[model samples]
Target: MKWIPQEVETYLSAKEYVDTAVIPVYSLSFGEEMKQSAAAFEFISLLTGYLEKQFTGRILLFPPYTYLKSEHIENVVSGLSKWEETVVQNEFKHIFYITSELDLRMFENKVDGSLIWLPSLPLGNMNEPQKIEVVESQAKQLLSIFTQKWSNHE
Candidate 1:
C-alpha cells in the first residue's frame, strides 16, 4: 500500500497485518546542482514504486522525505529519528528507510529501524529494459535483506 487515500484506508483497517513502513528519503538542491537532485528523487521514486507494488500488503510506502541538499544532515537525521519513534509507537515493528542518498548512512545507528541504501542510479535516460534491469538488481538486494529480517523476527 502507498500513501494514497484508498490504500491508506485499507492500511488503517488492517494495521496488524501491515507492520512494515517503507519510507524513501530524497534530497533537493537549488540552482546549478538541481539536475543531480532531480535524478536522486527519480531514482528512488522508481525503486520505491517497484517495491511497493511487490509488497503492498505487508508494506506501506510513505511519501518521500525531501531535504535541502545544503542543509545539515545531522539535523535531518534527528528529525527522521523522531519520526521513526512515532511510527514505532504506532505498531510498525519493522521500519525500513530506503534511499539512494549515501550520506544518510551517517546516522544509521541512531535511527531505531533498518536503513537500506542503494547506490544512486541515473533513471532519467534509461530505456524500459535498462530500467527493469536496474530495479531488478536493486530489488534482489532488498529481498534478501527483508527475508532475513522477517525470518529472524519470526
Candidate 2:
C-alpha cells in the first residue's frame, strides 16, 4: 500500500492487517554533493517502492522524509520523532526509517522506530532491467528484516 488516495481507502478498510509503515529518508543537497544526494534518493525510492509492492496490504509506504544535507542532525532527529509520535498514535505497530545517510546511525537509538542505514547505490547509469534487478535484490534482503520484526512483536 502507498499514501495515495486509492491505497488509503484500501488501508482504511483493512487497517488491522496493515500495521507497518516504511519511510524513506532523503538528504537533499544543491552544492558539490548534489549528485550524490540524487543518487541516494533514486536508490531508496526504488527500493522502497519495490518493498511496498511485495507487501502491499501489509505495509504502507509513506512519502520520503527529506531534509537538507546541511541541516543539524539533532534537528533531523527531532523532526522524525514528531512523525513517530503521529504514526504510533494512529496505530502503526512498527515503523521503519530507511536512509543512505550514515550519520543517522549515530542517533538511531534516540528514535523509537527502527532506523536502517543503507549505503547509497548509484543507479543513474543503470538500464531499466538492471535497475529493477538491483532494486529487487535489495528488497529481497529487506524482506527478512521486516518479517523478523513482525514475528518478534507478535
Candidate 3:
C-alpha cells in the first residue's frame, strides 16, 4: 500500500499481516540524458504501482528514495541500509528494494534488503498496450521472486 492516509490507517490496524515493505530507489540523471531519467522514473512508478496492487495487503510501498546518479556507491548503499532499520523496527520482516538503475547493482550486497534490478524501459513513444505489456511482464518477474521469498520464509 502507498503511504497515503487511508492506507496508513489500514496499515496500522493490519500491521500484523503487512510484513513486507517495498522501496523503489531511483537515481536522478543529470545532463542531456534527462529524458531517459524521466522515463526511468515513470517506468518505476508503473512497475511499483503494479507490485502494490498485487501485494497491497502484505506490503507497504514507501515513497521512492531518489539519489544522484553520480553519488558514491558506498554512501548510497550505507544510507539505504539504514532505511531498512526503520522498516524492521516498525515490524516489517521482509524488505525489498527495487530499482531500474543498473549501476546500483554494485552495492546490492551491501544493502540491508534484497535489491531487485530491473532493465530500464524507455516509454518515450510507446502505445498504451506496449506500456501495459512491459509493466505486466516485469511485474510477473517480480512477483515470482517475491513468491519464492514468501515460500522460503514459510
Q: In terms of lDDT, which candidate is stronger, 1 or 3?
A: 3
Candidate 1 segments exceeding 4 Å error: none
Q: Report backbone clashes per prediction.
A: 1, 1, 0
Ranking by TM-score: 2, 3, 1
lDDT of each: 0.87, 0.95, 0.88
TM-score of each: 0.94, 0.98, 0.95
Best by lDDT: 2
In Å, residue 124's CA in model 2 sits off its true spot by 0.9
In the range 1-154, model 1's lDDT, one tens digit per residue, is 9999999999999999998889999888879978888887877888888888988899999988778878899988988888898889999989888887778887799897898887788877999899888988888789889879988897
Q: Which one is best on TM-score?
A: 2
lDDT of 1 at 86: 89
- After superposition on all C-alphas, the RMSD of every candidate to the true structure, in Å, is 1.2, 0.6, 1.0
| Model 2 lDDT per residue over 7-60, tens place | 999999999999999999998999899999999999999999999999999999
How many steric clashes does model 2 contain? 1
Q: Residues 89-141, candidate 3, lDDT per residue (tens digit)?
A: 88888889888888788878887688999887998799989998999999999
